[model samples]
Target: MRGLLKLTLTQMKLYLREPVATFFTIFFAPLMLLLFGAIYGNEPSPLFGGRGSMDVSVPSYIGLIIVTVGLIGLPIGTASAREHGVLRRFRATPLHPLAYIVSDIINYLLMTVLGVLLLFLTGKLVFNVRFEGHLLSVLGGFLLGTLAFFALGYLVAGLAPTARTAQTVGMVLAYPMMFLSGATIPWEILPKGIKAFAQYIPLTYVVRLMRGLWFGDAWSQYGTEVAALVGCLLVGGIVAAWTFRWE
Candidate 1:
């Protein structure tokens, strides 16, 4: 337990020390929100059932932030560590493998939660957006979404042979999902074919679930999205665990 705590803190500190990671993980989402919100300024939209654009934009950016960390940050960090033999050195120690992986994951998750809070606060304070639903339900949806993406991150990290390859793979996966999964563009405004394609993407489910929870959409109506995210969590988690390598 002590070792896990130490590793978690160390991983967190390492992430904080990286300027790019610190900026994207902590600032980018809120900055994006501020930029778009300034242009759109709490305008009610028929696309989101007349809620302010910031409301939809804020939650979507939350998903984008998580995807950024999971799909790009984790994979690059893991592959770099592996390529540099950090994982091998850890294996030579007395610590269990789970401790190392869990610590890193938890560190990323904490950063994600912090990012979400910052984005939400910025949306509320600057754009006058408000959550119309229960806070706990929103939190539940966030946790589920985070877990699903974290598993995907682990899968990517486990499979990539080097940091460069991991980054290339992560970008290939991340960019399309960011644009098409309703993270940046409103899904209702997307073309029919694009919407159809988005239905198959895991990030789409996450964004929908988060948006629904934020707007007080009944949890009963979200069974399919919840199920899909849970399935991704299970499949990705198992594959990542099975494929993980020390060297």
Candidate 2:
């Protein structure tokens, strides 16, 4: 247990060591959210109904922004480490294998908190957005979304053939996720086929669930979205645990 803590911290510090990569991981997703929010941030959402348009969409966008960092950033970073022999080296150490994943998870949780707060603050200052939902529910959405996505990252890392391959895959998937998750293109605006395509993407509903929390929305409002997130986590978690390798 103690060793895992140390390993987790080590991976985190290493992540910080690459200043550019670190910055991209921490700020890029949020910046994209802000840019998109600024462009369409003022509009109403069709999915989240009954309230005004602006009221429902902001939080889901915020959640989408944060999840990208964890879901997208973690896999790329881990893949880089594995390619560079970091994971291979770690396996020879006495520490637990879980340490590798746990560390990335911890780093992302911190990133999630910071990203959400910073983006929210910026939204309030620049975009005039504010948190309106139940605090506990907002928190629940973030936690569950984080866990589900964290598992997704690990699963990606576990499946990649090499670190270089992981980076390529992460890059390929990132835009698809952002687009389908309703970051760049709002889900409602997409065609039926595109919307059907998005249903398979994990980040979409995770954002929906988080945004729902922020709006103080009822759970019933999120049936399809929550169900999708749960399904992704279950299937992805199994694949990650089964396929994850140290080297």
Candidate 3:
């Protein structure tokens, strides 16, 4: 337990020390919100199911943070550590490989939570967007979605031979998920074929579940979404564990 705690703290420190990571963690969502919110303003729009654009934008941005950290940040960081021989060196130590990966998961989860909170608060204060729905329900869906994406991250990290490869692969995977999953583009306004395709995307389920939970949809209303996320979490976790290497 103590070893895990120490490793988690060390991971957090190392990640935060990177300038790009720090900037994105702190400002990415807010900047995106500010840019769009300023243009769109805070009027109730039929485009966003009658809620203000910021309302949908806030939850979608949170989902983006989750996917971005899990897919892009984690894979690149883990692959870089492997390229630098950090994971290899740790193989000879008392620390188990699971502990190392778990620490990374914990560190990134915290960072994602921080980013979500910041975005939510900023939306409320600046854009006058109010959080709807049950808080606990929203958190449950968010955490489940986080785990699903994190497991996918582990899979990418395990497969990529170098940080650059991870970055390339991560971008290819993450961008599609981001754009089609309603993280950047509203799922409602998407074409019928695109929406049909999105139904198969795991991130689509996550974004829908999150938006529903955030904005007054019943927890029971998102059973399919929740089930899809859980399925991805299990499948991705198994693949990641099977493929994982110390170096």
Tens-digit lDDT string for candidate 3 (94-190): 9877787778888999999989988988899999896888889899989999999999988898888778998899889999998899988888888
Q: Which stretches of candidate 2 lie over 4 Å from their true place?
A: 33-57
Per-residue lDDT of 1-247 in model 1, one digit per residue for the tens?
9999999998889899999998988899999998888787887878778887887888888889989998998888898899899999999999999889889889999999888889988988898887888999999999999999989988888888778988999989999999999998878788998887788898999899999998888889999999999998999999999888888
Ranking by lDDT: 1, 3, 2
Summarize candidate 2's per-residue lDDT along 157-234 as a digit string, tens digits: 889887766666766776688777765565667799888878667787876787667867877898887787777779
Q: lDDT value for candidate 2? A: 0.70
Candidate with better TM-score, 1 vs 3: 1
| All candidates: CA RMSD (Å) | 1.1, 3.0, 1.4
Model number with the top lDDT: 1
Which one wins on TM-score?
1
TM-score of 3: 0.95
Q: Of the candidates numbered 1 and 2, which has the greater lDDT value?
A: 1
Q: Which ten residues in a row are the worst by lDDT in model 3?
A: 21-30
Please list the C-alpha lDDT of all candidates, in the order they appear: 0.89, 0.70, 0.87
Please report how far candidate 3 places residue 171 from its true position, in Å: 0.6
